[model samples]
Target: MRSEMPYANISGTAVAIPVTGGSLAALVRLPTQLPAPTVICCHGLLSSKDSSKFAAIVEDLCQAGFATVRFDFSGCGESRSASEASLLGTRLRDLLRVMAFVQEQDWNNGQLGLMGCSLGGYLALLGAADSSSVGVKALVCWATPFDLAGIRTALESGNLPHAMATASRQLGEPQDLAGLPPLSRVLVVHGQQDATVGWRAAIEIYRRMADPKELLLFEEADHRFVDPACRNMAIQASTDWFRKHLAGSP
Candidate 1:
């Protein structure tokens, strides 16, 4: 049986928000039982909670007894704008807070898993590496830009003046580019034809991971995974990763 669980409208920094946008936050745990593990799926840039892939996974997992939650970044979706939303670092902090809430929930088995696309994937790894991630038993990232500084450097001297500098400022520091967590179990899926976020970045992240990681390369897909076959592959791979890692008893 499936049902709806009211989510808490948390006002925290889960993602970047512009100054002019409304409130930014997540849609918390919807009710379910059977003790199936919990997963939090995060969308990519300029995307909302109901992205086709995200919604598909949420529907599948909910039926399979896993309780799931997805929220908007400060400046995106039903939440606040990029200007008003918290900074990038603060947004990552908000993601952690969401995990804390999941741990507190009676339905969640205290084992958490993460699914993030694009920049969301980077936040997942950076934050997961830095903190004792709340119940993050496994992580699956799609097209995450792990090498942010490198990307910025490449984009330096672009048409938009101060673009690189502004992004650096928001990032708030010069990371050594060495502290990425040695991931235990991770799955990285990227489109070979992705122009926006090339597959190389995902490869770099996979290389930096600790162990028990798998990378699936899509030869003909692009950044959006719009090709029907590619989309199915991505979702199936992600679901399988979460299930294999998070499907056991507490």
Candidate 2:
């Protein structure tokens, strides 16, 4: 028999967050306590809040006493807008709006945290790195790409905005790194055998961040952590990191 442990009370509500083009379809999970710390979950390219990996992680976070919000980027899930493709800046703006929306809720303490996977991870790091005013206190990134050039090359063959195509060339181009605010604490996780994006990107991100950071490389896992054991480890690590950093903060 497995050992039993008490989990924090959790509840979820479906809500639409207003954005420029349309409302973002999102699910907000709360830990039954008011003014609690919250973590916004960002999904990878072509993924949404309902993605299996994200859903599992969100559940773990909620049980660990953190409020979690997961939403679909424009054009991806139930959101109303339809962009031919998601731009880096657009994703950043959406996250900022989510931050604003969360702040309005009386139940939130305004102590924010972010967790992202793959492309989402890249956005999380970018958003938190420059988030002096947004109040992002901690970040968790899994298999994030450090550069946008590769993404552009892979997706640009399809329909994409001219400006977005041009912008991708500039993002993650070293100059972008200069503008990113220093992060207080960070956790970077990557699969050792990831084929989509190399584990080296994790190292690059670690190099860019300040102290009080950690990196975990899992062997025998792919980009999505296809293996159940790897996935479990990833969820546990992410939940623990957020708990350690986000606890006791108003």
Encode model 2's per-residue lDDT on 150-202: one tens digit a residue.
66665555544333323333332332343555575899999989999899888
RMSD of 2: 6.6
lDDT of 1 by residue, 1-250 (tens): 1223433322212332222334445554443563447788777656777687777767666656567778775545676433312245545655675666667666666778888888678767765676566647788888777566644454443433322223433443323235675877789889999988879888788888877789988998898888988888788878778777777624
- Each model's C-alpha lDDT? 0.65, 0.77
Give the runs in model 1 whose Cα sits over 4 Å from its true position.
Answer: 1-24, 28-32, 81-86, 149-169, 173-177
- lDDT minimum window of 10 residues, candidate 2: 1-10
Model 2 per-residue lDDT at 66: 83
TM-score of each: 0.77, 0.85
Model 1 worst lDDT window (10 residues)? 9-18
Q: Best-fitting candidate, measured by lDDT?
A: 2
